[model samples]
Target: MASEGGFFSAVWETIKTIFWALIIAGVFRTVFYQPFWIPSGSMKDTLLIGDFLFVNKMAYGYSYASCPSIRLQRFGIDVDAQDICFFLDGDNTRLFGDEPERGDVVVFRHPSTGQDYIKRLVGLPGETVQMIDGVLHINGEPVQLEDGGQFVETYERQGPEGRPPRCENGAVGPGADCIKSRQIETLPGGSSHSILNIGDYRGADDTGVFNVPEGHYFMMGDNRDNSLDSRFPASAGGVGYVPFENLIGRADRIMFSSAGRSMLFFWTWRSDRYFKAIE
Candidate 1:
């Protein structure tokens, strides 16, 4: 009888251990290294609609559950892992571990509806940002375009590529006449990256200057002609000016990439992009 009781106790302890382990793992995944799927072409030529990315929560800090009004979690938790965050909401709910810098690729909450948006930070707080003929001028110096990148040719018909189809910035359809081959112009910055301009005379090209308000940032998409960024007004669904509190964190790297149609669980994954650093 004693032996039997001991055996049952051991089994119960083992089961409890397994249950707690699963619970801990789930919390770790939910708080750190959450996956995000690209939903639009606004960040095209850089981030495609099918791209799967891992956002680093520890790269910034803990994200609090919005309470009464979504309160941020109190600090001092174990830093064993990080959460993948898409955007930082401005309710003072979450605080970043570090501040953003010029030329950093960032993901933030859209000031309009709190949707996540990723863009290149061009103008910092209290600076003048303007687009002159598709060229970005920060403060007083122009962000000149230097040619070094090769032509990125994609045979996938824009929509039939199995990516989400949207007319947001001029997407027509698969095999559509509007589909034109364009060059990926590499822009030199504090850190250089590529930009796509489909033909010239991009609408927001000739725009009035935007004096970045204090505690706000001026962001633009690498796909200049297509992205509705600070250049567009708030009424038109553009991410006008993001506040410092709205930043989630810096885009550290690309954890994975897949053809628009490939689900993340497939066996034949594009393992090459795994662990590749994001420019």
Candidate 2:
């Protein structure tokens, strides 16, 4: 009887420790940082698929969405989609952190879909944004564009057009006949990032003026022609002008990245991306 009681005591202690640890971690995640896993290539090149990073929760103050509710449903605490939509989807967002600036890589709730999205802030509130022949035009003036250089990409997975690396040009990678054109785009606020243009001419490359209304922002992906960004109207399956309240927090850096291979395949890890600061 004594031996059995000791075993039970040990197990109970272990459970208590685990419970306290989870509570502390939950508090930290809700108050300081929130981890996000990149499952898509929308922010490609800058942020790759399988990348894991933390969004600084305090970088933009706190919202109910960040108040331990984004994942509360998993903890048996339900969060309604309607409340998230009403509070986080548009001008309803309230924060005590600094206002968003141009060039910050932001994560936010998608207004229409209620899903989270990550993209670069290209246009600020009340700025006229347009794209002309692949050039980013802000307020009728073109931002500086520089030749970023070109490189052949070898894809590990089959993408569009049977290319291992699918590019904006509709997939053609690794073998003969891969798209090799890309550029470095500098935002008007003096931030530089790379962009890829696959030979395919998607209308996003040449879009008309978009007058960013007050309290709203414009977002885009570094992948250029392949991204469904503010350049495309929301009705056309793109994340059109994002509102300020919808902004979550900026992505500060990449914690690490994998190539969609099993975590056990340690060799598939992109170690160089560990702790890489976002541009």
Candidate 3:
């Protein structure tokens, strides 16, 4: 009888400890840093398909309107940790911790579906952005490109005669047998990044000469022709324009990356991408 009672007591204590730990973690993640798993390749080359990341939740101030509310613990430990929640510590209740600069990578809620998306900021407010003949221009100035890689070399497509032909990165698609070209882009405010041109031309190639309205953001994907972003109109159920209120925190770093299968229990993990800072 004594032995049985001791075993039961130990189990009970273990369960209680686990319950408290979970509750504490939940509260912190809600108000501070939260983990997010990359669900798609929309931000590919910057954020990979199977990357696990930590988003700075407090980087943007929280509103009861954004996340669902929950009960707080009574007599909870007041762990006054600044690193845990940075924005709340400062007097500036400005929705964002720091004013988003040009070329900074950000994660925000999709205006159309309320789903989260991670993309680089290309055009800033009050700036004129347009794509011309496979080049990105900020205020009519062309952006520069950097050495991305040789992935474009292996790319192939169909020839005019319908045979497999060597392709370029900007060749437009299977129908266009030219190497698709891209350029390193520098935003007007002096930030540099890259843009891809798939050779598939659209009217948008010469679009967006309008001045960006105040508090509105214009964003596009690094994949250029593949992304359905602010370039598309709202009637298409795609991201046309992003409002300030819909902005979430910026993506700071990659906590983990996996290419094959994402079984957490697997002992072998891809260590190369762990703790990598997002460019």
Q: 1-279 in candidate 3: lDDT tens per residue?
A: 999999999999999999999889877876677677765545655665568887776766663213422334586643322334444433323443455677777676676565667777777778887777656777888776565543242223211222332334334555333443445656666766555555554666656564666766778776675567777765685576666655566778998876534526235345788899886
Model 3 alpha-carbon miss at residue 131, Å: 1.8
Which segments of candidate 3 are over 4 A away from where they belong? 1-19, 64-97, 146-149, 152-183, 201-203, 261-271
Model 1 regions more than 4 Å off: 1-32, 61-96, 155-189, 200-202, 265-268
Q: Relative to the unseen true structure, what is the Cα RMSD of model 1?
A: 7.3
In order of listing, the candidates' clash counts read 14, 1, 17
lDDT for residue 71 in candidate 2, whole number 0-100: 40
* TM-scores of all candidate predictions against the true structure: 0.69, 0.83, 0.68
- Winner of 1 and 3 under lDDT: 1
When summed lDDT is taken over every stretch of 10 residues in candidate 3, the lowest stretch is 153-162
**Which of candidates 2 and 3 is the stronger one according to lDDT?**
2
Candidate 2 Cα outliers beyond 4 Å, as residue runs: 1-12, 68-91, 158-164, 168-178, 262-264
Task: Give the per-residue lDDT digits (tens) of candidate 2, residues 71-121.
Answer: 466678766444644454334556685778788889886767757789889
Computed on alpha carbons, the lDDT of every model, listed in order, comes to 0.62, 0.74, 0.62
